[model samples]
Target chain A: MTSSNETVSREIQLAARPQGAPKDSDFTLVERQLGQPGEGEVLVRNLFLTVDPYMRGRMNDVKSYTPPFALNETMTGGAVGEVITSNADGLKAGDLVLHDAGWRTHALIPAKTARKVDLLPSISPSAYLGILGMPGLTAYAGLLEVAAFKEGDVVFVSGAAGAVGSVVGQIARLKGAGRVIGSAGSADKVAHLTEKLGFDTAFNYKDGPVSTLLKEAAPDGIDVYFDNVGGDHLEAALFAFNPFGRAALCGAISQYNATEPASAPRNLALAIGKQLTLKGFIVSSYSHLSAQFAKEVGGWIASGELHYDETVVEGIENMPGAFMGLLDGKNTGKMVVKL
Target chain B: MTSSNETVSREIQLAARPQGAPKDSDFTLVERQLGQPGEGEVLVRNLFLTVDPYMRGRMNDVKSYTPPFALNETMTGGAVGEVITSNADGLKAGDLVLHDAGWRTHALIPAKTARKVDLLPSISPSAYLGILGMPGLTAYAGLLEVAAFKEGDVVFVSGAAGAVGSVVGQIARLKGAGRVIGSAGSADKVAHLTEKLGFDTAFNYKDGPVSTLLKEAAPDGIDVYFDNVGGDHLEAALFAFNPFGRAALCGAISQYNATEPASAPRNLALAIGKQLTLKGFIVSSYSHLSAQFAKEVGGWIASGELHYDETVVEGIENMPGAFMGLLDGKNTGKMVVKL
Candidate 1:
């Protein structure tokens, strides 16, 4: 018999560091006791949890932009949930908030760390973990700011069916791009990119060599490339770029699970004669664009000019599965876990 | 005997396309007759010819930023000469001018294609072919504009004893750089880089692995990398860069003669987490900075604050040999044929 002031919560912990591709044995679900909110703190009942590709880097103990996840400790990520109890100003029990306490059913966090999210009519709380969140902002900043995209430019994006890449391709089209091209893993995703996402052209990278496929798809050459899948995709983009072309290197999902180091992009010397610019950036550096992003992207969503997709997995116990599936390209768009 | 209005000229022509490293058999010395200057034309007595690494690209039959050299035709490059006769208003007899009619003893060219050079007492006319000319502007624009160099940056220059790299290292030091490090092919050039060129530290790339050498030289990491030798040098720079580091992809002399494609810079994926910016540029695209470059670099040379060196290879017939020698890293600075 638990006390009324105490609650039992189930949270996911890192059981072991992944060797290459993560396995079910690498994560474990553990139950913990949580007390009522202390001063300036709130008890959150997590409704949605996000599993992004970047988390793969955090599982490794190497030094990177973000610290690695500790072994046997609860992992943290993006979450959207309702405030169950609050001892903080401007927060109440029924209010919804976006935070970084994901992979768990509940979190007791400082109020300052949680941002109150207003529940709109049609948008679900899960949207805060996908289209209306980090992935959306990454697409906006990487394309417009990092890649320096201009109207009427030919744009190519890799991993076109994934969360960030799908939005990148759509945004390029909506922004008056002359032609938008995409490369994905499957034929259905290729069709989905062309027919549903408004991509002028799309190809299944598994069909043949990316360079030959890219050359056939973009005969005139591409001015901008939003690189989500690295390795062969990056090498192909380098070969297909026209002079003065620019590429925004956002992620390398293709090499994330590989035990061996990536070896493509052998034609980097071509950059010298082509006068290309390849800039790598993370979305956190561009948080200053959030207000402006919310305004522009929010307007597009409201008018039904922009489209978004999500693959939701049920239960906190399945969060690790959802994350592994996300890395394996099992999800078409943003993969989120629902409590 | 030749008439006053007619002259016999000796020129070098491309005999065969090189399979890999260029050799003497790839060139042939030929004699041709030149007529008097026509309208807007001038007859020039060539004084010096430049042998640069970029000329190796023109030897191949591939389409690049510049057109490939035609087979059995006179090979053209940067040259400084004395105008013997001028039908154009701006040029006069005995005036020193710079033009693109190299690998020859004499040339009949249009005045519009030639720029008159002002000969100073202390500066040699051949300086226009090296330190005071294209290579200088390449170093100037590449360091300041392409790399976006600032005052407190720790800079690294590969091929630091070569024409452009030497100037690049010197400029970085004069511009208040926090530290300057350079890598060369030989022990003597390495010593010259640190002792004569004001580089804070220098290393002979042949000693060991470039990554290990660079790590030993730059313990704190580098902010700007002016890459002249690509391949392993570029890969090392990528690993040595700090957060938000920038690299101006100036040249890849190491791979110019390679029959196979280069496979280094294997660590380019590090750019994502480090937020690196790698921009490739050509000197021709930055001609707008010429006047500024001349003023600043000219001032530094005049005050004896900057130093430049040249390897003078005598005779027009030796141009092919000099060019081959340059590719083999036989020259300390600019390699010019004194005709």
Candidate 2:
């Protein structure tokens, strides 16, 4: 018989590496007793959790920039939290912070892993995990540096209503790009991209062939392509790229959950002919650009030049559902969970 | 039958668009009378010609950095020649110069395309067509700027005995790179890369799988990958890349002649995991860096810090065979033809 004080932690862990598309069975939620924080560590009451596409890659045991999560450990993710009790300096009762504290109710993290939030200026704490954080920096650095955006350059963005993609389209326009076009999975998302985010043109990728839609939207050809969805989206971008065009490959959300390997690009030969520059990048590679990113994106947000939306789930237990919904293109913008 | 004078003026024209790999049947050599030089023009007696991998991309009727080769017109290429007649003010007869004069014995070209060469002072005239020309600038700019080499960084070169790859490996060493590893098709080519070209380690790609060879050569991990052969070589580099590794993709000889579509890389997911920066480039994209290239590389050759080789065929009539050999990886270095 279990005692009343012996509480269950109720955390999810990687059960097995998926061969292709991940299923619910790949995860196992376990209940265990919580451990107390040791020296120089703080116990965080995780308030808001983040479910991102990058986590899907971490589930695989392949070698990458960051190490994969081992089986039976709590699944890793970004989270915003309140420090309940602390042994670390400068952190006190009821102070909010951002950290890579996994999917759980509470965590005991080293002082260094948790960054104290200065919510003194009245910035929303949830925004620290979304628009003002990694996703915003990703859009800024990938578009400006990797894509080499110049004044009057026509830009095209794929998966344009998602977390990073929405910010990418708006940032390109703010940097003086001439015409910005976007692609989304649903009519509502497409409408949001154009009506809410100021995208010049937007298309529902599922409505028709992307090549036909892209040609009609970008008759002059695209100077820069910020790719989030790979597969047919990349092929269409190839056909639509102008001479000396640049492509910033940020993600391939379309192929992340594929049961079989993705198809080879039909227009692979065009890369050489057009003298195109295609760069694959991770946000962490340009971490030095963070201060510059904060200043520019923060100013843009303050001046109403950039806008963002978030889909929030209220409980930590719903993170798996949120992640699955992200893969299915269900969320309109950045997806976060309120703990 | 054609007269010798008519043959001298004639040129091979694009007769049919190639569906996959180009064949000799796609060209038609015809005879015509040479035209006189107009104002600001010089008539060149073409002495040498360059055939490159990028030319293969231009044979198809597609949009590119430069316009596609027109049907029933001379195929465009860079050439070195003697000025037979000059109506341009700054040029005179008997001066050696270089220009984009196409595949022909003689051409009337604008003075702007013709840059005067002082072959009498230092380097051989053929050096202008090989080491001191476009291929040289390509190696210099792409390696130094795009790869971002630092002293002690380990470098790997694919197609290491080829024109650009040979220069890239040598320059990396000259710039204080710790170790230079290279891969070529044959044992003789491998020996040349190590002994003559000064690569620290050289491997015959045909000896075994590239992944195994790469692991043995770069046990510590590759800091930079200069990719000239794309398919398996790119995959191998991805496997061996260290964190923050940079890949400057200059060419993809393995995929150029592929009749069917190549496979999608199974290891592409590594780009995000390792934070690897893989950038595709055409040399001309960095034209602003040309003056700096001329100063540095020009000095390197003058001081014997860099060495280059050319595989030259005796006559322009053998151009097709030479090009075929290039596609088959027969040349040891830069492939050129003497007219």
Candidate 3:
């Protein structure tokens, strides 16, 4: 498909606001006719569409860090695509680009808003949507910058097998963390975290109380925590933290789908005696670290010091299922839809 | 009382560890034989004893920032006293001093551990136990350093009529805060916070839910929070916080005496979207700021630009009752026992 008037694009739209957990009927697939790129715009065919946990927040018609996805309109997110035509300087046809126009088969984006990428054989275009992308940067900045991770500091990360947590554990291990502990939802993911991801210890949070499991894993206490799954995991981290402990709160996947308010982590008062620092942040705030992150993380990937996994759901129609599955912890790492 | 070998001192001892809220039976007044100053020691007669909320934490038999008060022993805390005799190089008779040896009418302490103070007609020695002492430094460091308070930022503080919170609100106002909001338990304390302490707005927490009261008090949202009373107050601050808000978790007076765990502030997950930073700290960790705090807060007091109130309980026999009253919000500003 090129930037011709005959080209057609299939996009997913929010059919209804989800009450509890989103179902198939909450989304509607629509096909729209494509037109040629206008001035300072480019037409691209999306190769991979990113399905992230944060997307669930956009599904609701509520004010947030990002605007809510309009009902019956194409929902937008990160996508890696091959540009078919460009009407702007410095961008050309056949160039691969990364942009936020996903949940669709194609995108017509402003040239300035689309970032051109190098096509490498060792890495896939989808890597831009996972490791070496937002999730990877989230981990890098959340650990090194936000959490103030230090050498020989014991590091604990929840959602250990997910995209951000996987990167966080590996980076801590590579950067000489005294110990790295991870918590996942499944035994397979727990095994993957310890065996493949080089976490010093891994536990399935579903097995028992998170506080008990975390205390058993990190007997000496953790100095830094990279929180991806909130709720009990955060409360447990609070219990397992040593004096002056730091936690970078990135996401709360456990509470994302809840219709009722979150009620766990009641032990937040423990922070006082322990003198803990809990900082919550969005990855977008640390865009200044993108270059440094790419260089360091890219080097780790190239040298095989870091590893990443992708659970790809083929076809644009399965994007919603992939996203819902991602939230349900069905994916081991980054969940993406290949169109 | 003047450092005689035959002098007797009246002291209060912790008879038993209280299960919940401490009572009169938990303490016992004792008569102890006093001795003259030994080598490098000073014998001081107590003038005032501080009764603070943190004493509640020390009453519980648990490992914490401060050790629990040993059973059947004289309880120790901040005291301002006048030295009668000294056996150290720079010591002299009739010198007023500050030391950590309260719950007693007299103290025999090392001269190095006792800080001599100027007996100013404008300020009483008791000011060293309240506005010009540990509580003063706590408010200064927690607001300016821990919370990273900035000029023109909206500031909200819980327990705003207490020693720490009153100072926190006044300092913020003096330093050009855009707005200052305070919460106290009683209507009188609320009125005192707004009318006397210069808080732009004040609310009695007993009026309604803290979140609703806070939202009404700070309509534009708070940029900084100095939390003295945690639990629901923290949850309310979380809801009233603007993006990138910072909270200094100094104390959790609300949950200190609770036999069970705290359950409020369940909405801490909101920190992620708001990009909030909550840091819990102890005043001892910030002793490096003592000189600066003294210079600033002392100047504010001397210039009459800042005002402080103290609820003084007569006699050392009422010390335990004063401490219990402090926890119950029976007094405004600092609660001290005048001996």
DockQ for each model: 0.83, 0.39, 0.82
- RMSD each, Å: 1.2, 3.4, 1.9
lDDT of all the models against the reference?
Answer: 0.93, 0.82, 0.92
- Please write out the lDDT profile of model 2 over residues A1-339, one tens digit for every residue: 466533345677888886676778778777767555678888888888888888877888865656898998888778888988788887877988899976877777887899988762656677888788888888889899988889899999998998899999998888788999999999999999999999999999998889899999999899999988877888799889887788888888878877676664555446654667777788887899999998888888888788999998777667778778888888978888887
- Per residue, candidate 1 scores C-alpha lDDT tens digits across A1-339 of 578998888999999999999999999999999999999999999999999999999999988999999999999999999999999999999999999998899999999999999976799999888788999999999999999999999999998899999999999999999899999998988998998889999999999999999999999999999999888999999999999999999999988877886788888988899999999999999999999988898888898888888899999888889999988888887899999
Per-candidate TM equals 0.98, 0.89, 0.98
After superposition, candidate 1 runs with Cα above 4 Å error? B1-4
lDDT of 3: 0.92
Output the better candidate (1/2) by DockQ: 1
- Locate the minimum summed-lDDT window of 10 residues in model 2 chain B: B1-10
Candidate 3 residues lying further than 4 Å off, grouped into runs, are A1-4, B1-4
Tell me the spans in candidate 2 whose CA falls farther than 4 Å from its real position.
Answer: A1-8, A35-39, A87-89, A118-125, A145-151, A259-261, A265-269, A272-275, A285-306, B1-10, B35-41, B86-88, B110-112, B120-123, B264-266, B285-305
Poorest lDDT segment (10 consecutive residues) of candidate 3 chain A: A1-10
Candidate 3 fraction of reference contacts recovered? 0.83
